[model samples]
Target: ALLKEMHAAGFEPNAATYNALLGDALQVGDFDQAWHIVDVMETTGPGIDFYTISILFKGYKGKRHSMDAASFDRTLGLIQTYSVKVDEVLVNVALEACVSLRDPHRLSATLATFKQCGWTLPKQCAMHTYATLIKAYGQTRQLDHAWKLWSEVTERKGLTPSEQLYGQMIDVLVTNNRLDDALQLFEEMKDVHGEHLDSQGFAVAYAMIIKGYAQQKECTKALQCYDQMKEHGTRLGLVVFNSLIDACSRVGDMDAAARLFR
Candidate 1:
């Protein structure tokens, strides 16, 4: 409100006003206004150019949200146009913007942006970037490469693998006809990350393992896994039972399958 009065009175807003506008847009994540303010500050003066660019990045973050996403390419174009001398925060935001794009080709190009900016991808940023890449790769039928990357990341130093991380690995294994590998990693997940696996996770993971074995024509293993899940109170839902029945029929265990249904 003070800023509007100052602008109206032919008194150009001060750095504080400019700073406030940029900050408010960020704190509240008003991306549309954030970008507008960025243009205004850059037009106003370079005294606050860096600060404005930083806010523009925040604006981009606001757009990362659904129902608020703007044109990422447009934001990227403007940022690159204005970032003749961008700093670390600007670079980080730009890389994050790439993650939000969820475009495999564009995201791949972000590696170059990191190189050009001389900025290290922070762990949070790296994890998300890798996750987006994994999803893209899976959709593009590049599952093997995604698995390879997942393995490398799992072995990285000073980084504990997360549920999402292990889940990605399990996804790759199951997709690639590697049921045994998925089961082994599921156990490894329990051993290495005790108390982290919740009931939902246990249920989901066991279901996938059963599905994988069924695909492999391994009925006995699937039934065993189902029993184990039930023992843990992760109720064996109807879908899992249906899958078990299918597996039993596939491997010539109709009697076992009948007993299961009863």
Candidate 2:
């Protein structure tokens, strides 16, 4: 209605005005309306810019399940179609979408497309970006790729790994049945960032390691990890507690299992 009023008043809405409307649509999860705005912009109003592409990508971040390959490809096609100069923010949003989608093929294709568009992945990105890429690789069972990325970040001069990054790497390692590696990394993390272990973020990593050990029937090791977690004052959630109980039952330690159950 407001747009109609503007049109009747002989006021032209530029790309920024349309971009704001598109953002509002996306914010309300009105993807249909957002696309309509994009279509109108493409046909009559100001052409799409990098911000437009970024907004679209950000909008899809939460609605990744609705984003199929065709939709993703069309979004990518816009960059070439409009000669949109990809910026770091846009690249990060793309990476996030790839992570949320958990499609390795799409992730690989996106990176390849970015390369073709002359934006190479930097040796170092924001730690959250690295964590998201690591998770995408991990979810796709690309353990080596995930590990290689972890090593790259650690080896970067003077760049301390964020706690979130460590948690992600630990998760990848634990999920891959590399409990020993995960434990070593956990210990290293404790030594470096021990004071911060009490945070709930690290608690999830601890739970992963405990669950890994439990799955392997290494109940004793699982219990040891639980003890360490307690020692570090990490919050024990139901997942960890349940893993400990199961680990005890697996080892025929009914007494311990009963104690954990309580």
Candidate 3:
């Protein structure tokens, strides 16, 4: 219909027009027709560009999330067969999907696919990519490899580990009962960037440390960390508040607990 309208109006349909049509097809659940449009673009002039490929990959990825495993793999196969240049955004999307799946075997397999295609984490890859992969490794209890990757990216690659990255590592460490290392990293975060740092990230790090200390029955240390938050005037979230309250209750500091509750 659109093509007929274009022809009637003598408006030459270009790549953008084809891409728009293809996107509409995907939007309406016509994957086969979308692929046909992709093929048309390949055979015609002005082949599929970066945006076109990104849209296709993004659409397939979104579709794959709700699909069964076989359908998901089929979508992945279609994406892999594309001959377009894969950018960091595309690779990041793939990594995020693998992480969301939470299957270490699938994660490793996707990584193997990356290896086969000569794709590595590019130096300019966004922090989220590194964070996602770190999280996947953490979920798999591959802490050593996770830390090695973190260190390589931060120290060697010269990427500044964002507070979220630090939070992720700390959370993973605390999960694995590596409280000592988690505390050390938490202190590093605090000492490196002293008081008055207003960020949700800092709040998260604080909560993790407080929770870990509380779990260890170090109520004094937990309260001390809580006090530090007050000193810095960093805004606290409900999660932190809950951790502190739990800490006080665990230590039978009913008075302190009530004070925090109020």
Candidate 4:
């Protein structure tokens, strides 16, 4: 019905018409046709403005985190060209795209721009965002990037790295065979009195470091770290001690392993 009007009115289907049709198609999950309509408008460009581009982004925001970077660039261009006021929701939506896509390159860029625009992220949410980026990198065995961001998290994240984040880095460092650095990271996570510092910090940081070192066949370092843990008045869970025993057994130090396991 509307197609007939578009055909008769000779309006040439500008961005507004494209957006309205896209919305209707999306409402019924007619996604393939929705994309087709968007592409048609893009091909017929210069008339596509911020509101139109933003409408398309709204449609794809959750479904495709790592969409064609070009699409986001086009949308951002629309925002700039139209002098649209930026807001937290917009920045967050961009970040959400980064998280789902795990595209650190663009995510990092967006985070910087978000700060430049005077958007203050909540401490908790910022930690999660950074952690998510790091974890995604770690999953891909991209330790260099992961550690680089981990350094930023510790030095300037405006919040203590959560136990989970710290644990993730420890795992990555161990994977990269950089056991000493991992142990040092674990130490930095400690507080003045030598406690694990934050709630459950030891559970993730200390325990994971020990496990990683053991897996790396560097049981000595693991034991050394365990001793340090005791000196700091942190209670060692029996499972942690058992892990050390297992490490010793793997290296033919059965006596030491047996002694601890006992």
Candidate 5:
């Protein structure tokens, strides 16, 4: 109705105007309405731009779990059908959707499409981008690919890995059951990036290691990690406490579990 009013008022709606409506629809999870807008944009003038593509991908940001393959494919199809010029923001949004969906094939396809559209990681690309790609590979159980990206980021001259990057790498290693490797990287991250991490960062990094130990039934190591975490002034959270309690219970140490509970 507002669009009709705009037309009646001689105010022609362009890509930006439609992009706003598209963003609003996607933000509210009104994908049907969003798609209808996309259809209108297709039949109208002022065709889709990179911003339009980015907005479309952004709709799937936190809603990837509810997204189906067909929806994903349809969005990807837009890029080709409109020949949308790819940009870093658009590429990142698409990559994130692929990661959230845990679809390695689509992840690879997205990367390829970005390359075909002349998008490449800049020399000073954000560490978070590499971190996201590493996580995507990790989710797909492509450990080698994850490690390669990690090495690329770490080996880059004068580019320090962010705490989030370190955490994501550690998480990938631990999730792959490579506890020893995760621990080694954790130590490296502490030596280099520890001063930069706040109490919350310390808690998160320590939590991952502690939980990894607990999952392996190494209750002693988990407790030792908790001790170290406390020494770092990180207030213990419920996750850490629960993992410790479960670890103690798993080892048939009710007494230890009671002590932790207390």
Candidate 6:
């Protein structure tokens, strides 16, 4: 009715006006109405832009709290159907929703759609997006895929992998009982991105390594990692120190444990 009145008044609704109407429709869970507004926008010129895409994505995200998995997917379907272009931001939004839902099938489908749309993964894809996908793959025990994405993000894309990503990769390797690979990646992170790392980041990496070695009952290597952490001037947290002491105790090196405790 409002749109009808606006059209009758010779007031041609632009994208903003249409977006406003879309928001109102989505607010009430009227996805059909929302898509209709999007259709109007596309047909009337001033077609959907990034901002419009963002608004639609955000609306789906907001609705997820109350919507079931099927409903969430339907709302997202509208974006895929109506999106003018699938840029990195839009892809991130879709991936994010999939992650939150833990929908691996949806993730695979979204990537397939991304390719079908002739959208290559943007070189400037944000690190968080890479991290999220890596994590999603890791959780599914697809370690190879995780590492491939990591390499592309850091090497081909030339984006510096964050300490969080490094830590996540180390944890994934360690969890999968690939201790040697974990150690290698641990050292590689420090070597390749050492200058980019802060003390806390180094601490996180060292703690993961120390915990990994300790879990494997390799007290000597765990101690080596602890010493390395100190040498790097990383502020060791109490949890890491406890892990080191536990490693010593596990190896019946009470003297070393006592020294650490003191």
Best by lDDT: 2
Instruction: Give the clashing residue pairs of candidate 3, or none.
Output: none
Q: Candidate 4 lDDT, tens digit per residue, 1-262?
A: 5756877987565566777887776556566787677566656543555456555566675454344676666556555555555564565455555456646576666556555555664555555566655665665567887877876766666456776677667766776777788877767666422444434556657777777767877788778877867766556877578779767867978787766645
Query: Candidate 3: global Cα-lDDT?
Result: 0.74
Worst 10 residues of 4 by lDDT: 191-200
Give the winner by TM-score.
5
Q: How do all models score by TM-score? A: 0.55, 0.83, 0.68, 0.46, 0.84, 0.59
Candidate 2 lDDT score at position 138? 82
Q: Give the alpha-carbon lDDT of every model.
A: 0.65, 0.82, 0.74, 0.65, 0.80, 0.75
Candidate 5, residues 1-262: lDDT per residue as tens digits? 7788999999989989999998898888889998889888888748777788888877767554456677778888889888888766676777777776777788778777777877776777777788877787787788998988787786755467778888889888988899999999988988987675445666777888888988899988988987787677777989789888887877887787787756
Counting clashing residue pairs in each candidate, in order, gives 0, 0, 0, 0, 0, 0
Q: Could you tell me how far off, in angstroms, the CA of residue 114 lies in candidate 2 after the best superposition?
A: 1.9
How would the candidate models be sorted by lDDT, starting from the highest? 2, 5, 6, 3, 1, 4
The C-alpha RMSD of each candidate to the native structure, in angstroms, is 6.5, 3.1, 5.1, 8.8, 2.9, 6.5
Worst 10 residues of 5 by lDDT: 60-69
**Worst-scoring 10-residue span by lDDT in model 2:** 62-71
Model 5 regions lying over 4 Å from their true place: 60-69, 235-242, 254-260
As a whole number from 0 to 100, the lDDT of residue 11 in candidate 1 is 86
Q: Regarding TM-score, does 1 or 2 come out ahead?
A: 2
- Candidate 1 lDDT over 1-262, as tens digits, reads 6557977998887666786777786677576676666567667633444555556556546645532235555555554565545555666565566555556576555555545645543555456456545644554457776775676576654466666666666666776777778888899877876574446656667777888888888899999988877667775777678789889989899998998857
Tell me how far the alpha carbon of residue 180 in candidate 3 is from the true structure, in angstroms, after superposition.
Answer: 1.3
Residue pairs that clash (backbone atoms under 3 angstroms), model 6: none
